[model samples]
Target chain A: MQEKNANQVRSRNEIFAERTSTKIYLEQASDDNPYIASAAVCHGYGVNEVMAKKSFADVFYLLFRGELPTPDEVQILQQLMIALINPGPRHPATRAAMNAGIGKTDPAHILPIGAALLGGEHQGGGIVDEAMRFLRKQQTTDAATSAAAHLESSTPIPGFGAYYGGIDILANKHAAQLAQLPGAGKALQWGMQMSRALEAQGVGWLMPGVAAAVLSDLGFQPRAGVCLYQLMGAPGVVAHGLEVANKPITAMPFVADEQYFIER
Target chain B: MPEKTFSDQQIIDSLNARRGKIISKTGGWFPGKGVFSHGYSMMDDLVGKKSYFQIVILNATGKMASAEFAHWVEVGYSCLSWPDPRIWCNQIGALAGGVRTSAIAATAMGVLATDSRTYGVYPLKEGVQFIQAALVNHQQGLSAEQIVASVPSRGGKPLIVGYIRPIAKGDERIRAMASIAEGYGFPMGPHLALAMAIERVLQEKYDEGMNVNGYVSAVMADHGFSPDEVYQIFTTLVASGVTACYLDTYHQPLDSFLPLRCDDIEYQGTAKRAVPTAE
Candidate 1:
């Protein structure tokens, strides 16, 4: 059993290593592009289109429960959402922001400002908007079916692909996963149709970037998306952080200005 | 009939040889970084002069093999420190040993200290302020029990666990992880099967039955999970399942409906009942 466990761990480690290697290579290959830094910020934060669609529900599950949910678990989530819907603003930070501003302000800006103050630099409005959009879209049509149809019809889908790049395997996988959930048959059906549509149109390959652009146009500010992505990407960040939590960062020696003066 | 060469206690003692240097280095939880460590130091500076307490630093740095892994451990440790008070020192090379050894030392010292204020510090390089607050509370000898008593149940922050499935489709490592997850009673495959099954049922229910929420609850309840775990389990299970099969629409017809099963329920069930059941 120990040996088997060890092997399993080893295999996981290898997969992670391979994933990291590919990412690093991509980073290195794209280092010369000025947009890479900005793109990196988005990618690092997990704000791209793919993550926007699926990770929220996944994250919600992990946060509330210790492990992943089953299909039944997904239903309970829907119920919980229903229960919590219209509970009114409960966040203290938002309340504090609202209270701090004594002067009467426009409700539109005031609400967003209050939300922004409460959310701070880490919250991404774009990610939230995208998530809401995907949720709303899925609510009306089968998510997979719609997604597939969107892909096929060459119609812009919100959260099915990556932003600023090619198709995101992660998002695709996540969407596919979501499609499999109880009642996601329609979504799956749509996704299939979309995929076929995209292939026929020869634009399936470019859908992610287009989807991202559409999301951007739909009021998902890139910076807000980035912040939301960071929050969503917390797990990966934590994983990386734990690796060196105990070890001392090798301090780089600093040379005094006087030394340079003396040499001169 | 073998000669009694050694007593059972003696044999046990021999096997339990004294392990070397238990507390090797301070972890982020105790003193390395964040507001907890900062607050701890501030409080220590303020009260250590007058308070009767021993500030021992519990370190878990030596056990960390990589820079990234160390950072993650530090972050987790920092996050866990919020509910307790312990002074976390931020000095490097102050303590030593593996995670287990350091944890044992901290527990021992924590239990033995006379003053409730006795604390430990574990710092990280880039600790967040929220984490620091937790560490400060820990150093001040605050316990989860005390925090719970003082704060409302719903007011406390929820604990967060982050994970990533970075493996590509068709990777042997992915397959291996799946297999291992299954072996470890993870229910990755079963969960996917169940989700697919539930989705079909939900679709049918929507056509012939109640509201979305009702159908969802019924489906989830059938699988023995409270509604809360459904979304998360579905997310992971579906991701893993799709990735495992590499079922790109191009490769397969993608038209067939997959059946789900109850056996794939791999998750922590609701808290166990308080009473014992008859055999």
Candidate 2:
């Protein structure tokens, strides 16, 4: 057994006076039958100690949200996960993962690099997260006015265009699929309203906007929505990273005449 | 019974023994020992039931945190996590993408690259502390210049003076974050006011503006987050951005980014002839 501290109690002020290295505080659970912290709580029982059975997705939700989600919530989580999981090599994070693998770096680093990139404010899940935030703030305003306002401010609209002025087919496809889910009714309707409002200006709803609206309707905050996006996107990133780990980067083809150098 | 002798180990252990809890007691209703998160009422009976945000506050500041303030932290995180890849640290990821570095290596490289005048958590944290300290000085009767100058120099430079990628006018991110802070019911403290004053003072005196770095300092100070705590908590907020840069340019051949041929190297020093014929 580890040695107990001198006194088990102290005033908060006193504790502040002598801040020590971070101590892992395990309350009430003594050395014998020690326990680790978990985020799953269901049916008034500890998931680990009490054997509360749940689906993998439900368990994941519990870990982040601190309670088992309803079946509908589970369905939304699944829908979002399947939709946002992988964008393949063209996406920055996936490409990062592939880049790592091509250089024959360790398998451990691939997904991490990809995931990290995807989480940035502009790229990764961050852009969508920002877009969702923009949408929420504009809840009082109509989509057209809001879109115009965003354009005026020079702030990038979250779910508008994938290319310079183009919509992503896959993203629209996912939105269409999600529109049919149990709780996605009103949210999808609102999303389409925004999409139609923007479409005249050659703008369309991308996955993030649809995701943000749908998740928001499902009661997830924008931050939580981004976390979910990140979670769903990681496996695809890792897969890309793993696939190219054995290959050397130099073996990849190069475009002709792309190698111009100034010799002066 | 064997004769008992005082052992040195026992003596040292007893001498080093503490009389009070080194860490504070939180009656926890949250996750512990991987048993899943317990609700507010549980037989687990740790000490206190706290939200994850509450625990974060406890860990950072040995104080209880209100739900609103904790949410402010979430809002703040959303703000800082969006520096695009073109910025300094994220560029490492871009370079990695261009160079075909390992994903982890690129991320690791980018994470490490955060240590600069531009990126890294410490600058913002330290900048906030500087403002706090400066306000104390200003209140105690010191000129703004004197207060700014009073901040110690590492290699003769004030650590938290100005922004990197120096914004010509001012950083809008500050206003964005400030608006968010105001929405959270956070009032501008003396430190924030002092930072603004100092920015103007410096700008008048040295033509500097209070950019995102100064604004971040103000926000952290407003939240009552000690400079040390800010760094400890949000170290990896934008690590994903770094990884994204690596992925952003993956379509190109290895080292295809800014591809330089043999002649691309401008050999200015000790040009030409190397081999000695006599040898």
Instruction: Summarize candidate 1's per-residue lDDT along A87-155 as a digit string, tens digits.
Output: 123233343333333333322233333433333322222333453345335645654466566656766
Q: Report residue A252 deviation for candidate 2 (angstroms).
A: 2.9
Top-lDDT candidate index? 2
**lDDT of model 1, residue A115:** 39
Candidate 2 lDDT, B1-279, residue by residue in tens: 001211235444654553222322423222343222222233332235555655566555555567677666655556655536656777778888886877777777777666555556657666766777777788999977787677665544444543322424445556666666677777777777777766655555544456666767766776677887766666655577777777877666776665543333332222222222221
Fnat score for model 1: 0.00
What is the Cα-based lDDT of residue A207 in candidate 2?
A: 62
Interface RMSD (Å) of model 1? 33.7
TM-score of 2: 0.47
Candidate DockQ values, in order, are 0.01, 0.01
- Per-model CA lDDT versus the true structure: 0.30, 0.60
Error of 1 at B220 (Å): 56
